[model samples]
Target: MGISLQKGQKISLEKEAGGGLTRIVMGLGWDAAKGKSGGMLGGLFGGGGGESIDLDASCLLFDEPGNLVDTVWFRQLRSQDRSIEHTGDNRTGEGEGDDEQIKVDLAAVPANVKSLVFTVNNFTGQDFSKVENAYCRIINGSNNSEIARYDLSCQGSHSAMIMAKVYRHGGEWKMHAIGEVGQGRTAEQLLPQIKPHL
Candidate 1:
């Protein structure tokens, strides 16, 4: 589970509280690509498949401004569902380079969403590695204004996991980035860290 989206659970990023708040953001990053088999671990203790986890994948935003596309690269993954899935692999330098961003159309959002869940996946099975300062922020929307920003970065690992963020600001429902790193994959392991003492 590790901060994941369950069935019948939809996070709403649309601000209908008369605040004119609109827009959703998602970003990803990774370690620097130089040594260690040119970014990704070359020889491992497993199978030999899948594309290289190195290099950068261009960002794709929906209903965005002109000539303002392709925010950055972060070795994004090709998984189930593009817009909703946030499992990207960035095997590059740590700290900072260029944050990868993706935007969604606020007006085009579904009406069944109550909150938005922002998930990140960058487990490369290589200890002694670190991933720092990776997250997403809302930029703009229908009212020509910006909303709140979320922090989606955390410690690094070598397995598949997710961190979900649900937010409620000023009587408005906003999924402010709530990503986290855990031991295993399960809602039980993550729910505590996310909504502890609840």
Candidate 2:
């Protein structure tokens, strides 16, 4: 598996009303084109040049083998306090991220925490559908009976940040399809990206 990790970016979770958390591990990976023009705009009207992936608002979770969450497709699981890992990798074609691996220890989370959220936003893209084969899964802390996942790259659009859902699943505290908010074709605005689901 190709995993990438930024020095200061990774998964995160916090709960104020729950018992206590001690360990949190997050895995992140993405496919790189490494050819032709990069995903990020090389020069906006011949202005600035930079990397290919901007990850100031991305997170990870545990899931299956074939399942995947590519780029900006994991917008169905909405976190109350959504985790945002920024790495400044904003291009999609020219270059690649650090190591395709990220790490987060739950034990390191802040105390007195209440609720958590996972949101993927603020990506420079020519289209949203280009961000394909996306998915996410959250592993349970108790008995590990929790399992939640969603398909995030189905819509036809090619350039829209999404808000994934985050709620309990199977009676075992879990995260499910909190629903998507940016990939909708008709929903032209950001509000429509997540409001109708509410």
Candidate 3:
């Protein structure tokens, strides 16, 4: 069983798995909230089946001093160094499990890249009030086992969230659930907001 992380909780990846984790996957999932119109009527009037939200998952690499290093998202699927890659963009939060995934080769990351911040945003500018069952999970890429997951079930009006972060700690990597909700449709806009949390 995987561990469920609360906001602000931190866990060491190496300590939890009892070995060095070379690769990891950050998975983001969500379900669109039901529209204002009820069941049958909603389906008939383009309120249900016709509606979709585009929530984008991104990873921002930062140096030890919190300097922006690089980013990986829909617009840029892979980092310049190829250490991080976004699987694809999910136009709608359909299906079960992970709607989007960002794979990272921890062992291949540059030495200067000391921290990785994960974020989710409604690229369409839709508020989180219309999103539900939102969650982020860290999976061990080798065996596909989930090491930890953070459920962002707190519905609100914010359009973006600094979901979690992984940083170098004592030569090992650790994860922290930031879970800080704010207003931003892209990672660039959230830069200032992510500073204090680092």
Candidate 4:
């Protein structure tokens, strides 16, 4: 088990790992909201309208001045410098855990890169009202131990969320849970909402 985080909470990776940490995995998971059943007739005739939600997980690398230096998302699986890599896109939030994952090699990251912001977007245009159990977690890549988790409990008409950020603080890396809901179908569209947090 790991420390569960609320919105705006922050945790230190080195402190949580109990020593130096080199690599970490940021995992995002969610499920489509189950549709209402229309009684026995609906079940027999397949009237339940539960549809799969396509949520995209993205990592944006920023410099000290908050400029976007690189990105890793569905469109681009790896950052330009090769320090951050996204596992790939999962169209349906169907499986048990980690619908999408982005791995970061902290040591390989550039010195100027101060923050890695993680965001989730409803690429299919469905609002979060149609999604459930969305969460972002950080795992120690070495031992697969969960360090921290932030449950995204915001359910509304928004299409995107600036979930959390891993940033350099006093020569160590720390994670802050943002959990801010907004309107964006892609990482590029969410840039404006991310600056305030950076």
Candidate 5:
């Protein structure tokens, strides 16, 4: 079983997996909160329903100096070096499992790259209070086994969350659950809030 992480908690990737973690996937999932009234027409006509909740998952690559070197998100699905790639974007959190997934090859990561930050934002401008059963999980790419998971349990008025970070620690990679809340419709707007967490 994988470790359940709390805010600001950190764990070694290699240690958790019992071996080197070369390739990994950061999976994010969530469910849209039900409207105060009715099914679909009620929400569309009188309540907050029918409208899709567009949540975007993003990965920011930072160098040793904490400077952003690259990004992988909906618009830009692949990094320049191709070390990271976003599987695809999920406009609504209506699916069964992961709404969005980002794959990373640790061995292929550039020497200068030291940190990869994962973030999620409500592109539709809906607050997290309208989102339920949200979680971010790390999975071993080779065997598809979960290594760690962080649950976003608290509902907030914010539209964005800095979910987690995977960084190099003493020649080994470590993962940290950040869980910081902020206001942003896109990843670019969350940069200011994300840097502080790094």
Candidate 6:
């Protein structure tokens, strides 16, 4: 068990690990909300039931001035500098855990990069109200141990969420849980909503 983060809470990675971390993995998971039966006909025809949600996890690298440097997402599995890599896309949120994952080599990250923002977008255009049990967690890559986790309990009509961010602070790495919901289907479309947090 690791530290469970509340919305807007921040934690130092170095302090949590008891030392500097070389690499880490940000895992995102979610499932579709089970729909109520719409009468006998609905159940017989599978009208009202749980449907698969296609949520995409993305990492956006930003500089000190909040300019986008590069991104790692389903389309682009690897960052331009090669310091970040997305495991792959999981279309159906039907598995047990971590529908999508983005791995980062903290030490290998370019010096000019100051922050890495993690986001989840409902790419299939379904609002988050149709989602359930969504969460974002950080795991130490070295030992596969969870360092911290933030549950995305905000269920609404929004189509996207700015989950959390790992940023440099005072020569050390720290994480902040944003948990902000908005409208966007891709990282590029979410840029405006992301600037306020930067």
Q: Which candidate comes out best when scored by TM-score?
A: 6
Which digits, one per residue and each the tens of the lDDT, describe model 1 over residues 111-177? 3333333344333433322333444444443443434444433334533233444344455555533
Question: What is the C-alpha lDDT profile of model 3 across 55-152, one tens digit per residue?
Answer: 99999999989999999999999999999999999999999989999999999999999999999999987778678899999999888998999999
lDDT digits (tens) for residues 1-198 of candidate 2? 212212122222233214343333222223322232444552432333333433223543322221222222234222232332322333343333222212223443223231223444325543433343443334334333223333344434444444343322332222324434453222223443343332
**TM-score to true structure, per model:** 0.44, 0.40, 0.93, 0.93, 0.93, 0.94
Clashes of each: 12, 52, 0, 0, 0, 0
> Tens digit of lDDT per residue, candidate 5, span 1-198?
699998999999989988878999999998887763366634543466555678899999999888999999999999999999999989988979899999999999999998999999999877886788899999999899999999985687899999999999899999989999989988888888888766
Candidates ranked by lDDT, best first?
4, 6, 3, 5, 1, 2
- Residue-level lDDT of model 6, residues 20-82, one tens digit each, is 689999999998888734766445534666667899999999999999999999999999999
lDDT of 3 at 118: 98
**Lowest summed lDDT window (length 10), candidate 5:** 36-45
The models' CA-based lDDT, in order, is: 0.38, 0.33, 0.90, 0.90, 0.88, 0.90
> Regarding TM-score, does 1 or 5 come out ahead?
5
Please tell me which model should have the higher TM-score, number 3 or number 6: 6
Mark the regions of model 4 whose C-alpha exceeds 4 Å error after superposition.
36-47
Q: Write the per-residue lDDT of candidate 4 for residues 1-198, one digit (tens) a residue.
A: 789999999989889988779999999999887773377634542456666679999999999999999989999999999999999999988989899999999999999999999999999887787788999999999899999999995788899999999999999999999998989889899998899898
lDDT of 5 at 121: 92
lDDT of 2 at 72: 22
Q: Which ten residues in a row have the lowest lDDT in candidate 3?
A: 41-50
How far is 195's C-alpha from truth in model 5 (Å)? Answer: 1.7
Off by over 4 Å in 1: 1-18, 33-99, 141-153, 156-171, 183-198
